[model samples]
Target: MTESTTFNFIDSARRTVKLEQEAVGLLSTHLDDNFTRACQMIIQCRGRVVVTGMGKSGHVGNKMAATLASTGTPAFFVHPGEASHGDMGMITPGDVVIALSNSGETSEVTSLLPLLKRQGTQLISMTGNKESTLAKAADSHLYAGVDQEACPLDLAPTSSTTCALVMGDALAIALLEAKGFTAEDFAFSHPGGSLGRRLLLKVENIMHSGDQIPVVSPDTSLPEALLVATSKGLGLTTVADADGKLAGIFTDGDLRRAIDQGVDIRNASIKDVMTAGCKTTSPGMLAAEALKVMEDGKINALVVQDEGRTVGVINMHDMLRAGVI
Candidate 1:
């Protein structure tokens, strides 16, 4: 390590990223008829898309398969080495196989071609070498070639692997669009995540309904409404009419304003101090949407109404507890 050859880590990192970035950018030109054919074949597949590769290509294949599965396509990864030792049983004639080989000549990957051909399984190959054996043997070949490796020796699979991953992402997104996958569909696939909770959880699921709701009749005195608000712990209480319909709401803000205006809290009814026709929401609405409604109105809670009748009440803290915030 001479002073002249200080080995600038930042310089090396920037160069590697720049090379990989260009590799990903150039992959667009390779999205030709072959890419479309591969997508069509997978779309028509009655069974899962079984991805197989060896070494570094195998790592990329694993992620590609995961992406496909999460994006409305049924897919999984199988190691090509294991495929030769009976893992090929996992694949079926109705399935489509996606094989990856950077040099397009991995022996383990190529060895399964005969068995796949015997099963009459369609093949889609992703390779850096267009003229390689694996590319020629496939039903369709997706070009993931890179001009140069980020590695100074031009040996390591750097830019080439990046391009393969980007190309696989392109394929998954295209299939997702073609299948008309919605956010709710994605939430169903990932039910345990925050995104799923935000998209799938409705206001009714986490609202305080029936006896849990803090409410009082419009003629109830302000002091009594304060007691209901405190007992329910929602910082506010709804004011209902004789017909059991929402009339208005009395919140902590109303109490503060009444004090500032020197109003009589003991004798004045909630109807005199309640804020009428305040921001309201529906129980069928998404909890995330309800959170937005609260945010838009700068209010801490919302009354859930159905046909102008109060069904439930939700607050910002409830949305937070449900992970809708």
Candidate 2:
């Protein structure tokens, strides 16, 4: 036999994926009242959701806890082995505990049942065997049973772990939607991530305000307005009326158009070569929203207005510097 034909790696992967897909698909059909009950239990908990498991289940539990925490339900993972070693103190009576164990009879996890019961901590179990001791002890049992393992020997945990992870994700999302979780709420939990920056960062926080803004009066000469725009390095300048209200905007593009019309910059007023009623944005608007405005209008900057008065200017360069782009 050729060395390449000795083991068909692609066939092995396909079979494993097929089995795991079937396992997860079956999970949806088996969903019952217990799933809803578990979500309710988590939502109503005055304390956080405490997840616990052993071995591969423990690894999955850690991710479940993180997803729940980030999605509005405060949760944390606790290893059953560590729980026996005093980390169990992390689980309070007000907390809901979700335990994962494919066999539903993991000694480390099952041993915590009596203690959790005595403390009145609600238990939600994800196990392959609904009749196992852990499942029977749980206030809510989530059956994650799979017909067969994706492993060639059917002895290794393959389909079971995938089912557990999917179940955890399902629970997190259900609770998130049930609680009216919003993008802003999610941003608060992930302030360091790009989505957080896009949602939480405001226009006022990064806009060029005060003296940094390039401004010129409508009567100012086109040559002087160009100097102001160049000095500010923002490629644009705002033309304000005598009362300090925005009258127009002069950009590099506007200068090009004026030149195309044979309007000499040396003999023109700033107003003659400027764009009237230019786009504007509020200081409170999100930087992400401002980017969209700039993109939609094909403009590089916006005059920041609050009640008909220009306060600052936000340009595409500002968006880029702030990582909003």
Candidate 3:
């Protein structure tokens, strides 16, 4: 009878999450002047931000570097063990070093402090041990201290690592905003990522322009319009006026509806069977936004217009191909 509730696995997970949450919540209080000082040092540096750490702290350092680099602050991770070898040559003057150490006593990380200091490089320390040697030696020290670990044994780097990661994010985002980092600037760094595509992929990049745009005159026969639509493979054709301005649009659905009402497809005028005032988009519109328009309007295609004249056509398949879907 007692074995049913002897060990509660769910309670264990809940306790770990609650402890870690409280740990992260406390980090905000310490985002004081020291944090700003760290950000300033990084911003003023002519060279890149070099992050270094050993063991679990090293894993956190790698992520910190990636976050910083992606958010407009140039940064990269350096393994402390390798710093003693030829890898240390990568560090040059004007570069700032952000060292991570839980105990502040990691020999591999501490060994390079004197060498980096000699180069007149600024050193920023992220450590749980603010009183440790590495902390006292740095120009700025960020306290990543936690009262207790989320780990049951208090041995693993649980709450401490989470604190480091969040601190890194706060630093990066603050710098990004300070530098007036726009979406276009972010796209430059992430040219192949989904965020880059959403911000930079324009309708014209994936649209059918020139001869690829299916067009039919207002007086063209419905059969001829159907041929233009099918031949272009867009399932629709724009009906233009004498001046090449868009008059209306004829889609496959219009053909089916006209046929159902016995409006002879072989002889009906295109203007009589077309839907006027079709929805249009500009070539400069983001393809992702165009996808939203297509979804909102319940239509699959949009005509690209500039000053009331047709420029091109963009459809759902184009969005899909451009990874905007």
Query: What is model 3's C-alpha RMSD?
Result: 2.4
In model 2, where do residues sit more than 4 Å from their true spots? Answer: 1-6
User: What TM-score quantifies how close candidate 2 is to the native fold?
Assistant: 0.95
lDDT, residue 63, model 2: 96
Give the true-structure RMSD of model 1: 1.8
Candidates 1 and 2: which is better by lDDT? 2
| Two-way lDDT contest, 2 vs 3, winner | 2
lDDT of 3 by residue, 92-201 (tens): 87899999998998999999988998888899999998799999999999998999999989999999999988888888899999999988788889999888898899
Best by lDDT: 2
Model 2 per-residue lDDT tens digits across residues 185-234: 99999899888899999999999999989999999999999999999988
User: What local lDDT does model 1 show for residue 169?
Assistant: 94
lDDT of each: 0.93, 0.93, 0.91
Clashing pairs in 1: none
The order by descending lDDT is: 2, 1, 3
**Model 1 ranges with Cα > 4 A deviation:** 1-5
Q: Which residue pairs does candidate 2 place in steric collision?
A: none
User: What TM-score does candidate 3 reach?
Assistant: 0.91
Candidate 2 achieves a global lDDT of: 0.93
